[model samples]
Target: MPKPNKLLIVLAFFSIYVIWGSTYVLNKTAVAELPPFMLAAIRFLTAGVLIFIIAAVTGQNLKISRKQLINTGIAGFLFLAFGNGIVVWALKFVDSGFAALEISAQPLVILLLMWLIQGKKIKPMSLIGVFLGIIGIYLLVNQRQVLNQDDSYIGIIMIFFCMISWAYGSIFVGKADMPSNYFVNTGYQMITGGCMLVLLSLIFNEEWSSPLVWSPNVQLSMILLIIFGSIVAFTSFNYLLKMVSPEKVATNTYVNPIIALFLGWYFLDETVTLQSIIAAVILLSGVYFINTSKRKVMLNRFGLQQIQNKLRKNKVQ
Candidate 1:
């Protein structure tokens, strides 16, 4: 196999870091003017269609086995439908800044779910990281403060559900049987989930025309979502996933909250409190430790020593 280009890898990492980081702010703006589910549906629908058309023109096979289609649809429902849908809905009541903070707790949720469902063992230090992340989330939620505020508690709960749904979706996607054409697979999933969202929007009787005066802002955010979040970020993420370890690719989650926080502050005049700063530090630290835990660096060190000793014994004997 040809050696992968280091430059391309670097570029992929940069794109994933920046593009994904900006999506939360974009989502916040989109939801501010659009019916959350309808906005999500439109975003994914346009993105998915454009991607599929491009793939077709490029002569990529869009066909999949029945099993593959089913799996893809299932993943779409979990990840985009529930995961992203709840996020869009939560933005209605939560400040984008606080919403970003809540979403940053996802890494810890994923870790705990992996342990429970897959019977994976976590390292001691990483377990501390999980606890710290939980504390950060507790601070972010501010149940005492939010309970008295109108609809704040409900929004917080919705964001928490968003986190859990995303965690579950990530796991499901990992286990799913994917198609050979990754781009096509992604397109299908987005299209499927987007359609589901549209159906849901109708069921909830969310008036699509309610935010007519906010059209310009909503349109701009939608365009950004389709171009940056769906197209650019997804392509960068898949490229990184193929070229690097999954753990390394997952680092975008940590990077995204930082970008979201800054963008929310700059564009939305969102305040960053001491608690937010503390939460950001603790959250990033927790994500770092949790990601590294998967590698079991401490255990690997012992394994390496054991291998060296075995080699020495063979030589001596």
Candidate 2:
């Protein structure tokens, strides 16, 4: 590969690491003021529309086969509508930092899914990661504060399910037929996922409010989630996956939790217990073990070889 732009690389890495980490706090702030599903729906719907507008204006092909559309839609429902939407809902009960810490175990979840569902063999290093991850999760969840909070365990459980959906979606997207254009594919997933979130909001009868009526904090959080979290961060993510190595990209898994924890404690007055800190250390260490495994294949967001293949065929990387 030709030499990568060092400045662009740094900016891209910063975007994915910090911007994506901050999304947990942003979502927490917004859902406090707006109905969770509605908040997610609007954020995604707006981002999806803007992405499409950008795609069209830039002359990217928007075409897809029926099967590709179905697969992409299913992937979107798994990845965004359910994976992300449910997390937003749970944010009402869970601290944003805690949620970020929990989600950091996604690689562990993916590892087990590969063993159970796909019958893929686990590397020895990954097995150790799984062991540490389990202990970490126990420590993270078995805290007195979390147990004392009303329905917080329920929120934690729901977020666990969200991780499953996210891991499965990653595996699915790795093999499923997607739109050749990565940007266009992302646009479709956003629109489809946003539509599903809207449907969910209606089914649940969530109270909807106009953006005009939101508090300044909620409005700013919403804007940040849509513009930076969804658009800029995702674009940066795809760019980095293509420009650099997946192992380097996977560093975001651990760094995000740290940022979330600090931001939550500083801005939202969320608690960060001593035990929670220990759990984060162990859990993220586990994720590190898995990401650094010599076997370079990815079952979750851990590896992007499959994604890079798709981008190569499209030549959009």
lDDT of each: 0.78, 0.85
What does candidate 2's lDDT look like per residue over 161-274, in tens digits?
998997777667656677766667777888899999999999999999889999999999998988998888866665565565444565677889999999999999999999
| Candidate 2 vs. true structure, TM-score | 0.87
lDDT of 1 by residue, 4-52 (tens): 6799788778877888778788888888767889988888888899989
Say which candidate scores most in lDDT: 2
Q: Model 2: C-alpha RMSD to truth?
A: 6.7
Which 10-residue window in model 2 sums to the lowest lDDT? 294-303
- Candidate 2 residue spans exceeding 4 A from truth: 1-13, 237-251, 295-317
Q: Looking at model 1, how many pairs of residues clash?
A: 0
Off by over 4 Å in 1: 1-9, 143-148, 210-214, 238-247, 296-317
Top TM-score prediction, candidate number: 1
